[model samples]
Target: MKTKITLLMFALLCVSTLANAQKKQKALSFISGKISIAKYHEREELNRMNKGELLDLYIERIEVIVNILPNIAFATNSNVTMSTLGIPDTKENRKALVENKEASDVYFENTIEFQKKILPYSDTSDLIAAILFYESTLKSLHTYNDFKSN
Candidate 1:
């Protein structure tokens, strides 16, 4: 009984640690509203949650991506901003975003880059992935390589 209890406690502690580690909230303020999103972890803990909890998180994520579909659809040109937020929130990220030091700036100044190679005439799904790439934990230059692999 003591062994079982000890194992359960250990598991709980591990989960709490992971949850704490995974917390990254990025908020965007616009005239319409404020969006403070706790982005999806790369490990995909949603699968462990109950159906309702899964749906809630999934829907919030999807809603953010969904709203931006029109923007993607109407894109008249190519752009790839390496920063998660178009503007950098910190001095370090600002350097990466501003000096145009990122790998993609070799392509354009206004656009955001994708970790995965997007085919020509990339459609709505591609656009969604690109935006979600910014709003993800993998905000580094190599964003969404996992998404592409999976």
Candidate 2:
């Protein structure tokens, strides 16, 4: 009987532990979709938006992503780029985001810096979620290329 009680308590503890363990947030993919839509839906007009406008849009999305990141995207959002983060290099740019190895490398380098600042405040799961969004945004950027530049 004592063994049975101990086993039940152990099981309860395990269940609680699992429940409390870091769970990945859900909005990363959503943020990715937003970034993709913004980048791909319109290839040309995207460039006309002023830097402040562009940054504001990004900030809006990042704010939403950040709200979901730690419990988050600002501290870790510095590595944003024209290709990797789904922004266009130029009005006629036709580059891919994730598939473009060079672009991805540059993006990763930038993101690493943000991670350093964010890591002290967040868990692995949170960062992974942010990364998923980053990758998704990259994949989405390939949707359409208005014109190719040499």
Candidate 3:
């Protein structure tokens, strides 16, 4: 009787652990998909700018606007995940957030500088529109994923 009870408890523990692991995997997949969508949008925006298709004035403002949304999303997501994992969302505690902020700032600055240099050669409105579209798409994807997760 004692041996049977021990075996049942162990089996139950294993099943619970497996279920938790599966849940974690699902959450991770959702997070990965969100990150990938952001990256793809950023790359597409850069490609359009590099093609000299954006106008000077629009490129100048749009580049900054386009980069800001993704930066905010990344920061928000990082903080939320850290909190969910019961980790402190501090600069000293979260190295990934620190690194992400540094890299994103540099990228944002560089994109602006690059845009200024090429503004005279591209169509500003078109560049702005393209960036806006990408951002909107990213927002939609995030919303859909959030709903799906819930």
| Best model number under TM-score | 3
Give the distance in Å from residue 27's predicted Cα in candidate 1 to where it truly belongs: 21
CA displacement after TM-score superposition, residue 13 of candidate 3 (Å): 51
TM-score-superior candidate, 2 or 3: 3
Ranking by lDDT: 3, 2, 1
Cα lDDT tens digits for candidate 1, 10-124:
9999999999987764432211111234654443443344444433444454444433332332221123332323555555754543353233334322322331233234443
CA deviation > 4 Å runs, candidate 3: 1-81, 88-93, 138-142
Q: Of 1 and 2, which scores higher on TM-score?
A: 1
Q: What is the C-alpha RMSD of each candidate to the true structure, in Å?
A: 20.8, 17.7, 15.1
Winning candidate number (lDDT): 3
Q: Report the lDDT tens digits of candidate 3 across residue range 49-150.
A: 644433433443444344345544333342245566666655565667556656766876787688668655655555666656655655664565464444
* For model 3, the run of ten residues with the poorest summed lDDT: 25-34
Score residue 43 of candidate 1 by CA lDDT: 31
Q: Report the lDDT tens digits of candidate 2 across residue range 58-92.
A: 33445333323331122223233444555435434
Q: List the global CA lDDT of all models.
A: 0.42, 0.43, 0.52
